[model samples]
Each structure stands twice: as C-alpha cells, then as structure tokens.
Target: TVIDGVTNTTTTVTAGTNPNAIAVNPVTNKVYVANLNSNDVTVIDGTTNATTTVTAGTLPYAIAVNPVTNKVYVANFGSNNVTVIDGATNTTTTVAAGTSPVAIAVNPVTNKVYVANQISNNVTVIDGVTNTPTIVTVGTSPYAIAVNPVTNKVYVANQLSYNVTVIDVASNTTTTVTTGKRHNAIAVHPVTNKVYVTNQNSTNVTVIDGVTNTPTIVTTGKSPYAIAVNPVTNKVYVANYFSDNVTTVIDGVTNTTTTVTAGTNPNAIAVNPVTNKVYVANSGSDNVTVISPSIDTALPLTTAVTSSSLVNVAGISNATVSSAPAFTFTATSTYAPTAPAIRTVYYQVDSASGPWIQASGAGPFTATLPAQSKGDHVLYAFAVDGLEGGATAGSSGEGSGNSPMVGSVAAFAFSVIDPLAQIITFGANPGPVNYSPSGTFTVSATGGASGNAVSFTSTTTGVCTISGTTVTMVTAGTCTIAANQAGNTDFTAAAQVTQSITINPILPCTPGNFSATGNAPCTPAPAGSFVPTAGATAAIACAIGSYQPNSGSISCTLASVGFFVPLTASTSQTPCPLGSTTLITGASACLNLPLLNIDNSDPATVYDANTDAVLLTRYLLGYRNADLIANARGTGANLRDAAQIETHLSTYIPTNQALSPFDVDGDGVVLPMTDGLMILRRLLNPNALNVMTAAEQSAITANAKRGSLTDAQVLQRIEALKP
Candidate 1:
C-alpha cells in the first residue's frame, strides 16, 4: 500500500507482520526486510515489488550489509543470535550472542560485527576472523549500535537507561554518556566523528563529541527511531516513528537539526556517503524515500591522477615525473552505487599537479606517472569516491575527464638533491653550575646543528678543562668556557660561551672559652673530656696567670658567674661553670640572669660572666642559632660550633644563692668517698673513668667547680665535699 498525495488515506504492507528493520542492496537492487513475527527475512527484488521469505534467525529484527564482504547480518531477537547470510549463495551462519539481539551494524574498516542485545543490556562484539562473540556491557537495554570509521568509535543507545555507552576501539573501555530520554537510534558522521542519537520519548536528539565523550542536546520530531549520516557533507537524517515525518537534516559540525515532511512511520534510515544521499524506510507507507545532502566542497584542479593508472612512457607502473605538467585521465568502479567505491588519485606537483588518474584500491595509493619529457615534478596522492555520476574508460584510455567525488588526500613532496652539506644550526648554552663542596666540575656546552665539528676551550687551569665539546673542572673555582667550530665545519655558525662555575669548601670551628659578668660575651669553654697537649697546656698556664685572652680572643672575668678556661697538663677541664641555686632537671636549666658587658681593652675582659646571655636567649628564642652565628662570624654557619656552645652553657643555676660543692668524682653514686688519690685516678686516666661503671662516670661528670679552679683541682675539692 502507498500514501495518496491528494487524499488522507493511510496505506500499509500486506500482513507480513512486524517489519522492524529494512535495507537495500544497491548491487542486486534488492530490499531486505527483517520480520520479527515471521522469524524470517523478506527479500524483495528492487526492480520488482515481488517478495520472497528466507528462513533465518528467530525473531529477526535488524539487518546490516557489508558491500565488500557481500554478507548480510540479521539480529535474532528471540534466540539471542545473529544470522550472517552470503549474498551470492544465500547461505547462512548463525552466531550466538546475548539474551535478546535487537540491532546490528558493520564496521567498514575492520569488517567486524556488532549486535545490540536489548535484554542483556550489552552489545556482543564479534570477531570477523574467528567468528567469536565478546559481550561488552553497555547501558540498560542497548537498542542500537553505530560505528564511526574515521574515529573508530562505537556508540550504543540504551532506551531504558536514557544514555549512550561509547566504546573506544583502541582501549576497549566503556564511558556512559547521558543522552535524550529513551535513546533508540544512533548514527555517526564518518568524516566528522560526530554521533547522533534519536530519542524515542523526549522527542530530541543528542549530539556527541567522539573525541571528548561530551554530549549536546538537539531537539527533533517526536518518536525518532533511527538515524543515518551522509559522510560526503557530514549531514545527518533521522526517522521519526510517530511524527509521520523525518528530521531531514543535521549539521554534524554545528549539531543543528531540521525537520522535513515524509510518509507515516519513518522507521529506518541509511546514507550513501559517496553520493551524499539518505534513504529512509517508511514503515506505514511500506516504501523507501531518498534525499540528497547538499554538498559544498572545494575540488583540486588536478583531479585526473589516480592510484591504478599512474605510469610513464613504457606504461610501466610506479613512474616518476621531472616537472609539473597538465594531464588528465578517467575514473571508474564496478560496484553498484559505484560512487562509494574507493578510487586512487595521483598528481606530480607541489600542490595537486601533474597528470591525474584514478586507480582501483582502498586509500594511500601508489601513483603511475604520465609519459612526459620534464625538468621537475611534484607528486601528491589520495583516495576518493564517485557517488555522483561519472564516465567509465577502458584500461588504456586517457584520464582527462571529470568526476564529482569526495574523500581524503595526502600530498607528498620529494626534491632532487646534489652532494652538498645539509647544515642544521642551533643556538647552544649551558645551565648554571654553582654547587657545594670544593671539587672539579665539567659541563660540556649543549646545542648546535648536527655534523658540526665543535671544539671547546677554558680560561682557568684545573678549575676546568675542555676536550672537543666536553668541559671538565676538578677545582673549587669559577671559570668560563667557549665552544667553537672546526675550520672544516660545514657552515660558519656562531660559537657558544658558558657561564662561570663555582665550588664551596667545608671549614673547621676555632676552639676557645670565656668568663663574663652580667650577660657579658663570655665565650663558653669547650666542654666535655679534653686531652690538652703540651703546647696547649703552656698557653693555658700563661693565660691563667696573666688573665689574658687566648688565641681565639676568648676572655672571661675572674669571679664572674660564667667560666671560660682551657685545660692544662695537671688540671682536668671544668665542663660546667660555678652555679648557685636551683637543681638541674636532666642536663638543662632555666637560670634567670642579666646580660653582661664585655670589656674590649688590654685584656678585653668582661667583669660579669653572663656575657653571652642576651645572644644565647635570642638564639634559643628564635630557634635559629646557626643563622645568628653565621651573621656574627661573617662566614658560613657551622652547626658543630653551635652544638659545642649549647653543651657547656645549657645547664646553669642562679648565681645569687649559696655556693654548693662542685664535685668531679663524689656524685651520689660515688658512695661517700673523699680520697684525693681515687679522684685523681678517675680524672687522669680515662681507662679508670670507663672502668668506674656508668654510675661512677655520672658521679664524676656531675661535679661542678667554679671560680679560679682547674678541672683536676675541682676533682680534689669534689673528694673533700663527698658524703
């Protein structure tokens, strides 16, 4: 039945029942209809309306065809299977899939099969090689699948989930993208990779970004069921099932929709990308309507060169041309709808020049040069289709002709060269190299064209050395270097100069001690066990008598609270200063003392022994003793020196209280011993000190002697003070 243009009567097909999917084979000119209720495929010869039923899948619903493979895929809804029919022999191969297969699509590039399983909520991926199925989970109730050849992205529409699941072919990862309500149909613009999904309930379309997986909503007529794209113009056509009209156009690039009037129940759609024409299956009208996508593309001037026909004077394939010349050729294809067939295109000019011709191949074709006597030539090649009408030619015919075609092209340029230096020059420079620790460092200059003879030289010895382009330095000094090209270098390019390199060295701390009053600058004596040499003992003895400063300029008052004294041969080093009141908690003390002033005179003495009180408090409060010492000494900071000062001065008592016994060996653990002989043995021989046990060592170390007393003399006093 057919719809009358003048009357309002609705026509329908004879009771073939539940015709769900429809497709046409342009080669055989046959129309295939998948009948869900009949469990078979309805084949209608395109030239004649007569139809024949072939038993195929159970509850067959959707159908797709591979032009190259010449096979038709049918979705078996009831048996969860697909029927692959050989068009030539009409034989079938059944492949198992998910619970309920509803729709199917074929990938032109890989010739793989994809079936949407509605009940399983996934799509079954079929390997064309092994004919095995891999079920890939999609959104709920996947109703349709479409593949974009250019981007190799597969889009599946889920009616119940209201979303589309995109499958990346390379990674096989699934990303769910929200779409219009009840998405039922999907199609992809091959060139743009823009996917269009038809919403059955919300009466809208969803535009998807193939690369970013982003979705843009587009409104369409009510109840859109299927969609198709014209690859030639990147336009889309959607079939609206309930609106009784078709959304005639979609601009893939802009994602715009436009509706056009059509017969009732427009259910299925397909596009011939080559001709830019769309075919919509009107279920109610039981007929297919064709619409052309308006194309506006620029055509190259040299369209005649093609893949199969390029040749030289001897007609040998793979010919070379010396110069650009105007030549032409014919293009033809044996496939029906011959326009979509891939044809080879070739030229021998920088930008689309030389004798152009078409060959029979996929894409990326080899060119045959036209016979010519030339000086120079540039060749460019690509693949195109002739969906629009064009003339056919014999094997040995001239390619000078016209064909309306659109496809991809890649133009390559190769120049004839003589033996000459191919110079590549680059500016070279070195990064900063000022490192810690005094040592030699070599930094070779980087950057400059390849094959340039580079030589380097330095201005300082041992600090840096240069051999060829490499520079090495082993000294702790700064030096500059230059890299120059050899005389026989290919080209005269400017040389590179390097920045200076510097190295730092480690330093040792000077030793001394001081006694100051009123928080004076009394350099605390080096604390802990000290083994003074003969020379050091002599210096200490002289300084002790004359009350003079030591070599480190350390001075102290005779009766100040703080002590600064060096060790002599007969005196043990007094580790702690004289103190008065509070008991020490652990080894640390909080002694409230005033700052003392230092006398920078002949002896440079500080009457008050608290010379460093203010600085010590400031250092402890700021928690930056190292920084303070670096500033005072006008040199790099030393942590070891700060540790030494802290060890000796960290423990103190109030200077105003009654003087207590400073015992060097009669601490509580020494058990009431006041023998001077034992005290001297513990002080003089460290082996005896070690043999005294930990308790004995603690007893001797705890002794505190102040005022003009040496370490050994303090030990004797400690023996006298013992309990």
Candidate 2:
C-alpha cells in the first residue's frame, strides 16, 4: 500500500515472500526490501510503484542503503557475507564477512558499512572506498549495528551479553555498556549522538548517551526488536514483534512513549526525517506500515530574515527595520507536502494598496532592495504547490484555476530610519606640563549636539589612560588623547579630535637640616649613607667600626674584626698583616714585638756549680781521700745545686768516716781531695796521673780515652771521677 500523505490515500503493491528488512534511497526515490525466504532483494520504484528483483546471498536478513552513494547492502546470515548492489548499474557484488552476518548499517557521510556477525560475536567494518573488511571484536552474539556519521561511532547490539558495544570508527576500539537483556536491534540519532537499543526479552528500549555511555530504559510493547531514530526530531521508533505494534519514543528533555498499531510481527523499522514519518516492516503480515507524526499547527511555516540588520524580521511576524541597506529571507515548513512546492514573499511600503511586489521566489530566498527612506513598510509570504497551482486565501490569484492548492500568508510590518551624522571637537588642547605624583589630568570635549556622549582613548596606554574626560598619567612619556562620539539614528558618526600631552620627570624628595641631598654626603660614605628617614634633620652616625658606602641608606654595615677603620664614617677598613695583633675593639695599627733565640750548649752557666762545690767542701772537709772519692762518686749527676749535694753527702756518710764521691782515680774507692787535686792536675798538665794505684790508673786511662778531649770533656771526666 502506498500512502499519499497529503490526501491520506493508500495503494497496495505485492512483493516477494518474507521481507524481513527494508531500506530506502531518498535521493533516488527507490526502496530496497530484503526477502528472507526468497533470498533476493526487491527494489521498488517509489514513483511508479514498479518492482525489480536482485539475487543476493543465502538468507538475506538485513538491508541498508547509502543514499549519497546510491548503494544498497544486504546482510546474509546463511552465506556469511554481504551483498552490495550499485543502484545505478543494478549490478551485484559479494563482500566476505564474519560468520552469520545478520544486521547491517551504513554511515552516509563516511560511506562505511558495518555488519554484525551473530555467531562470531563481532562486527565487520567494510571500507566503502576499497570494499575491504576489518573485523572488530565486540560482545557475545552481536545481532544488530548502527552508526552515527557525525560522531563516527558504531553501536552493536549484543544479544547474549545483554549490552551494546560502542566502536570508535577511526581507532576500532570498543566500549561495552550494559543494557536490558537480549538487545536485538540498535539505532543512533546522528545529531544528538544518542543510541537506541531494543531489548527483545526485556520488552524495552534502552537509550544510551554516546558521551557518557549510560543507559536509560524505557518500557515498550512485548518483544521489542527493531529500532530506528529520526536525527532531526530526535524521535526513536521501536518495532515490537509479538505485540504487533510500533512504539514511538520521543527522545527529548522528557522521554515519552506512544504506541501505534502496526502490521503483524513488526521486525524492522526506518525513519524519514524530512517527511517526519516512520516505516516498519512486518514479516507475519507481509506488509510495511507507515506512521506519520502529529502535525504542530502552531508554526506550520516559519519565516526568518537571514541577511543583515537591514530587515530585523523573523518568523513571519512584524519587526523593526534597521538602518542597514539590504537583507535575505528564509522559511521552514512543518507540514510535509506531497508534491513540489514554491514559496513566494510579497512586500509593500506604507500601505496594502496596489499590486504586491514579488520579493522572494523560494524559501530561504534572497532579494536585495534599494535602501528605503525612513518610513513604514509591510511584507507578506506564502507557499504554493507547483502541480496543483492553487493559492491560499489572501494570496495572489486566490480561488483561480491556475493558483496553487494550499498556501499560507504571513504579514510583517516594520519601520526604517535615515543614517545619522555628527561632528566632535575637543574644548582645549592639553600642553606640556610637569609630571604629577598622582598621575592625573582633566580634558573636555566641546563639539557635537547637547547630551552627546564622548569617549576618550589614548595612542600610548603606557604613558596615560583617559577615562571619560580625565587623563591619568602613568609614566614620563608623550601621548595623544582622542575624543569620539558614535552617532544615533538621527545623527551621523562624529570625527575624532586629538590632543597631545607631554609629562616631565618629577624632582627627588628634599632632605632636612644636617642631611645632604646629593648621592654622596661624607667622604667615605659614598652614595648610600645612614639617614633614618626620607627627610631627616641629621644623618645618623655609623657605629665605632661600621660604615655605609651609598647615600640614602637606612642602616650601616658592621666592620669586619680582622680589618680596622680609624676614621669615622669610613666606607672601608685596612687589614692587619700576618705577624701582627690588634685590639678587638678598634685599632689603628698592629704592634710588632722583639723575639730571642737560645743556645743549648752551655749547661754549667744554667746550673749552680759554685753552690754545689761549697756544699761538697763542707760535707768532705776532713774526710780521707778514699771516703771523699766514695762520696763524690755517690753524688753523680744529681749534684745540680749546693743544698742538694750537701743533703746527699751528709745523709749517706758512714760511721767509720766514709764519704761518697771521693774517688780520686775512678777505681771504685773513696778519695776526696786526692781525686779532686788529681783531676785538676790532669786538666792543667797533659801527662800527670801517678797518684793512684796501677789498676786505678789503667781504669782512669780507659774511661778518659776519647779522640777529641777538650777542657769541657776534661771537666765531665773529673766530675765522673768525683761521683
């Protein structure tokens, strides 16, 4: 049955048996139907209702058409491949696919085909350019597939897994989103990127947000299997197999559902966005059901001005005319017409008198008129059927035989105005002035009518800023300030006037009383000196050893201890040399002291020899030579002073008048003056040693034997003989 939407009339045509899937080429006005039992595709000529058969692979289960390319694809479940038919040549080509490919979809923009392999549980993406196949793994038992051309995302319905797999066409990566159980079919709204999946077992439709991948379940009729979406209206159509009805889900801010009686066993669905209609293929009934949306009469045909502000009119209503010169008009028709139609807009100035001038030929039509004078203007727009040639009421040639059948007229009234003119001038030109610490100045504009506002701008923002009539200086530089006025509808734009301003550098802050203003004050303190405050009565003196080198310094630095500065307010200090020491506080110069070196040769001068000799003489006054020699030998090298010699000689003297250190000839016998006189004689004469026995003399000779025996060695030998 072919239904004429305008007349609500129907016509029937026979097709092959068991038509499971259907697709249409809106551009070619042809429809392709996949006949499962016949294993062929029936191409129906939409205009003449003529049918042609093209053989396909075994068990053709699904069909999709790329209207842009005029190619139709059929998925074959039994043969495991897809059949592609070029609508122009009507020739068939078989492309290999995965096992049991049952569902097929195509993205017209990208010219790519996606086929869901039921048994293989994967999707095969075919490049429309090369006709090559790339297999992408998805969820288990993939049954249906859909693609959104705008986002280039393909959605595959996996029946066993109860989820939908979203595939990124460029990367072939898949993301699985859980949905209702037994998802059998899927559809996508290209504009919104929202996916609709029909769950067969759950009897519901799952709406999934492509960006978030979150699913919202909407309950539908029993056994909902086939789904389709209208991208323009964002409406989803679901075909229920068991319920024998089609559910319309309005995918808007609030999702709502409405069911309409469909042919028996509805299996496949498709939507026509331009016509705002849905087509459902019913296998059991062997017919297709066409459902039209309810008409919105509020705005049957909307008119708009597409061009500039010359005509600020839109939506077939009264508007204000701007001061611009030209504009274009466009229209949107809500009702789908059966035949070809043409939109015409007529316009008139100030009145509805005389014949209306045809200003536009078609919708989204453009016409540039000469600039109109400041006055009232009116416009009216209407659409006419090309075939019937009948016009609507209030349109040209109304009720005439040659006029369009159905038409609507929307009248618009507006007013225009003439361009404005203006002139602006500054009150007085600002001259060179001294730099101010506040960075402020005043300026005023004189020209242009009263109440005309003037704005100010500067050529150099770094030098100054002009807000209204005041110019604030930033730094020492020159800048030109401009005053301008933008005209209104009655006045033209004003020419800008400029004024140049020069700002000089400001003088430094003055110092008070004893403080100097120059960089350097004291001789040692150069630029930075201790001055406490900006304008001080007197400069603060540096500490005893500290000084400041630069002027305007807040504090002084301490002088290092190793170096000293004698003068006050000194910048630097002198360092002390290596071998000198200075006072810790403040020393002008370091002091140098004399040093002495000692010789270790003369031991007798350092020791008390005379005291030792007196103590020995008292202790051995009447002692015999043997006893004195014993006492002298006993007092060895310990006889450093007279007191020690006396203590040792008297404490150790024997009862028989025996004394130590009295051995005259080193024969281990006591002898006092004999040993001393002998030693002195030996020191005076070289060969006189006959006062002792032969053994003692031989011993003395052995002990005194040395290569270089001088007077010191003789004294050492005499002391050894006495001790």
Candidate 3:
C-alpha cells in the first residue's frame, strides 16, 4: 500500500506473501518489498503499480535500495545470506552472510552495502560493484544499520549490548557509544552528521553527535522500534510499536520532541525528504500509516519569508540618505491539521528581550523601521498563527503564541551610518593649457561624510564639461567647474567650491611649416618648404612637382604648367594666354611668338610659308561673289572694281539681301576694294588679315588643311608677317 503525502490518499498493490520490509528507489520511484514467508522480493512500479517478483534467500527480513545504481539489497534471516537484485533486469544474486542478517543499508555515493547480522553481532560490507563481502565485528546482536554516504560512515544498532556502533567506512574501524538498551533501528542526518538510534526497551531515542560521539537521550512513545531522519529539516522520527504512535524530535541547537498517533505496532519508519512526510509500517495493523510533518501542531510549520523586497544590509552602518527603505516581509506558516493561518506578525529591534510590536495586517506585510543611532542593530520578525491561543507577554526573551501552534522567527543585523561631515576642497586645479592636445583637470571633495555623494557642474558648458571629479576641456575658453555635496540629516551640506579651467586653441600649420614628431605644434620651415602633419621642428622644401601658393598650408599643391610659384612665399601669378609659351618656373604669363605667312601643310609640324599659302588658297576658293553683293547691299556700301563687281554678281542674291559675308573688317560693310584688298594682304602677310573675325580665324585654324591647328600655331603664322 502506498499513500500520497499531498492528497492523503492510499493505493494498494498486490505483492508476495508476508512482506516484512519495504524500501523505495526515489530516482525510479520503484518500491521493493521483502516477502519473508515467500522468500522473494516483490518490485512495484510506483507510477504503474505493477508488481514483479524475483527469488531471494530464504525468509528475507529487510530490504534497502541504492537509488544511484537502482540495485536492491534484501537481508535473508532464515538462509543467513543476502539477495542483491538488479532493478533493471529483475535478477538476483545471493551472498553468504554471518548468522541471520536482518537489516540492510546502502551508500549510493560509494556503492557500498552494509548488512547487520543479528545473531552474529557483526556487519557484512559488500562492494556493490564487485559483490565482495568484508565482515566487520560490532556489538552483540546488531539489528539495524544505516550509512551516511557524505561522511562514508556506517552506524549499527546492537540490541543486546545497549549501544550503537559507528564504523568508519574508510578504515573499517568501529567506535561504540552507550545508548538505551534494546536499540532496534538506526538513522543518520547527513547535513548535521548526527546519529539517531531508536531504543525499544527504553522507549526513547539516543542522539549521538558525529563530531563529539556523545549521546543525548530523548524520550519517545512506548517501545519505539524504528527511526528515520530528514536532513533538510533536521527532524528525527521514531516509531513506537507498543504505543502505536511516532515521536518527532526537532534536532535544533537543543533537541525537542513531540508525539503523533500512528497505526498499531509501528515497526519501521521511512521519510520522503521531498514532501517532509514520514511513513510508518505497522505489523499489528497490517497497514502503513502516513504522517505529514506539516500536520504536527506541536511542531508548527516554521514561518519563513518565502520572498522579500528588502535589500539585505551587510554591516550595521547604513549610509542611505532617502527615507529609510521600506521592507516587505512575506512569511509562510507551516502546514498543520487545522490548516493554520498566520494571524499576526511581530517585530522587534535592537534586542529580542522587549515586548514585540505586532504588525497591522497579515503578511507578506510592509513595515518601516525607525531611524537608529549609529551603531549595531538587530531586527527580529516572526509570525503567530490562528491556532495559537493568543500572544502572551513573557519576561524571558521568548514570546508565547496560542496553544497547539508555535511561531517561527528570523533575524537581521545591520547598522546605521553616521551623517557625513561637511568640508569642501579641490584635489586638483587647472594647470597650464596647451593648444593642439586639449588639457584636463580634476576636482574632489576633501572632507565630506564618508560615502557622501558629490556632484560636479560646469559654469561654461560650451567650453568644458565636468563628470564626477574630472573636468575635460571642450573648446578654447575659460570655464568654472564646481563640486557640491548635499549632506544628510546627520551632517551639514558642504559649501560649493569652484575652480576655473581654460582651454587653448589649436595652432594652424604654416605653408613652410612641418611637425617632425607628434604632440608639438608645427613650426616654421625654411622658405618654399611644407609638411603634412603637426609637431614638426623642420620643414621640407616643396618637391620638384609640387608647390605652395598659400602660407600655413599643411601640404603643397602640384604646380600648374602655365603658372608657377618659384620663390619662397610666392603668392599670385597669371596663367599663359593662348598663342604664347611659358617654359620655365615662376613665369607670370606665356611669352608671345612671331607669326609668318607660311603653309601649315603638316599641322603637326611648325607653321611655315607653304602651309600659310595652302590656308589662303582654301579660304579664297571658298569665298563667293554673292557674299560681297549681299554685304554691300545690306550695309549700303560701294563695290569698288570690276573684279569686285564680277565676284558680287557671280551668285544669286536673295531679294531681301539679309545675309552679309563680305564684311571682312567686321565693320558691317562690304567695300570690295577694302575687304578684297585686306584678303590679298592677309595672304601675303597673314598678320594683316583683319578681314577675318577672331571666330573666323579660330575656325580656320581649327579646320586647317594639314589637320586641326592650335591657337598658338595659327598665332605663329599670323605673327610671322607682322612688321
């Protein structure tokens, strides 16, 4: 039969006949039952409630499980041997034991098994992996065994010797502590390393501290035969077979015991630490009794702050300036039979000795603490449940709550920090300012309350900004940075202190200036020199292909062919015009060349007389007599000779005569002798050719017979005939 701790419901599963001992594997949730009469072990799946049986040594009296390996160990009293069952395979192996082995225990961490030989008064240690046995001598009639995997120690209860034997697993050595006579069961709390032994004869439990190996007898129900402990809660449970009740011992700094009713003849006890529930196997009742530790009124579910919003204070002195921070404490009352509800929460400061102040509402409730003098302080909080009769004042430090339900308490320790004293002083003032790289200054409060926060502000924000105690330069200007601290109630505010900071401008690099290294400003170099970066001690002359036209330029500009700056500090110059040449450096303008009436047969070659004649003949042949007539008629000018008349009448003239092509002087006239003679003179001396306009001359030069001719080439031909 298995009971759900949460719902208090029971479910039964069929097993082999006369099951004497039962153990659970928490990892797999499988239960192993030792059937003494059937001489087999019944395995029950907790989830499915399915049963499977495996043959074991005769008269199996006790069973234990190693959750880590999923192995089951059964003590066979009649056969004097132990059965090891593999939970995965449902197979068993038998190992010989001394006399009748009645109790078994396993250390999952070390995979070691301990079996108590009742008649032989010894314990058999079997290596779970190797299945090898090592016999260790104990007290007379060892009945029960328990192992603490963390400490690697084994404890056995010797019924006849009236003592408990503690064996060190590493050394295989035994130490005996006198306990009540007829010790039937043993259990250990791993966290506290405390050993608990249930005495059937004395009807009490002997608590042995593993550290000191000392025993403290705690009274329990009549004929207590089985014991178990919850390391999480540090609670020990003892099952009394005669009284049909179990004793619960709160293993605190001082042990406290309470009794809870159980089924008849409770012979074995086990605890599920996860649920804090104790299960007692009753032989007389032929059923298992489930005890919820939460329902024990004598041991009220301790009140603990499940969650909190308060920041824990490390030391006594708190340095908060804002109103003392409010703290919200949420407390949960332990489960009890009556479903205990928290009625009121009490708090006290400095000492727990005084009358406790009750909170207004049920928690989680918020409470504000009064400001305290600078020193150590303690705050204690606890909740009283409805089951408690009422709050009762007591002279002792302990507060009494209503009957049946007790209160749980928690304490906090902290100190209030003294107010900061006021004194203003600057640690560093502004030093000399430099240009290129900006400068920095620092300011600090010298004598202020410890932990007092200080703020910094800059009067001239545009020039500089202050962060914390440091002032950084922004631009070229003077700014004042101030440090201020606002004191708390304990200390007066410090006077604001101000310091002035000046930021210098970055110097411009000169044309002939250069920086050899970083940081330093560029210095003047020799004339006609320059550099690319700042901090130069010497300057470099402009490279052959580059020049500097302006001062203070970091680099030089490439020299344009037509104009140049040859000397140091040279500034302005004019570019060479068309039809001129400037071949040397620093020439203001291009030099003009002489023109000649030469033919430019090959435009690629220099102008000569032959190319000039070709150009004249082409222009002459393209001219028409009609152009001369139209020019004369539109401008009302005379046509001079027979040749002029003949040229003018050669082509058809428009009735309006709006077009004029014979305006050789571009004076808007067509005097044939003047224009025609001008053409003849130009052919002989092209420089005298005013008949052609600049546009006409440019066109002719562009469409020269040899090829396209440049302005310089046409100018050379035109200037060659100049007087």
lDDT of 3 by residue, 1-723 (tens): 767677878887898999888887654557899998998988888778888889998899999887657789999999999888988798878888889998899887788999999998899999999999989999999988888876899989899999988999888788999999897778887757788888888878888998889999888889888888765456788888899888875554468888888889998888865456788888898888887766433334444432222222222122333234345556665474456776777777644445788765566666777655433345667776676545466546355654744466555544343333477787665555753334576766565753478788998888888777767777876778877888755566888888776666665554446555433355565445565555555666665545666555566665454454444444344555544434344443444532221221223323333333333233334543444223222112231332443433232111221122222333433333433343334444445345556765554443232324444444443343322
Clashes of each: 54, 46, 31
Decide which is better by TM-score, 1 or 3. 3
Model 2, residue 437: distance off in Å is 99
Instruction: Report the lDDT tens digits of candidate 1 across residue range 1-723.
Output: 332323425455452568777765543445678888888887765444567777777889889876545678899988889988777677889899998888898775677889999998989888765678898999898988898855677899998989999888779888999988887778776546578888889888888888888888878888988887655455778888989888867776676777777787998776654334566778898677766545445343223343322222221123322222233333333334334555555433433323556543444344444443221223445445544443445634544456645543433322221112222232433424533334233454443433556555787856666665455645556666755553222223544544555543222222343332211122334422221321122123323312333343233223222222333221221234333212331112223231121111122322112223223333434434465344332122322255544443333212322222322333322121332233333434344322445555445434332234444554444333211
Query: Model 3's lDDT to the true fold?
Result: 0.65
Task: List the candidate numbers ranked by TM-score, top first.
Answer: 2, 3, 1
Q: Against the unseen true structure, what C-alpha lDDT does each candidate score?
A: 0.55, 0.65, 0.65
The TM-score measured for candidate 1 stands at 0.40
RMSD to true structure for each model, in Å = 27.8, 27.6, 19.8
Give TM per candidate.
0.40, 0.42, 0.42
TM match of model 2 to true structure: 0.42
Q: Arrange candidates, best lDDT first.
A: 3, 2, 1
CA deviation > 4 Å runs, candidate 2: 243-245, 259-265, 279-290, 297-301, 304-723
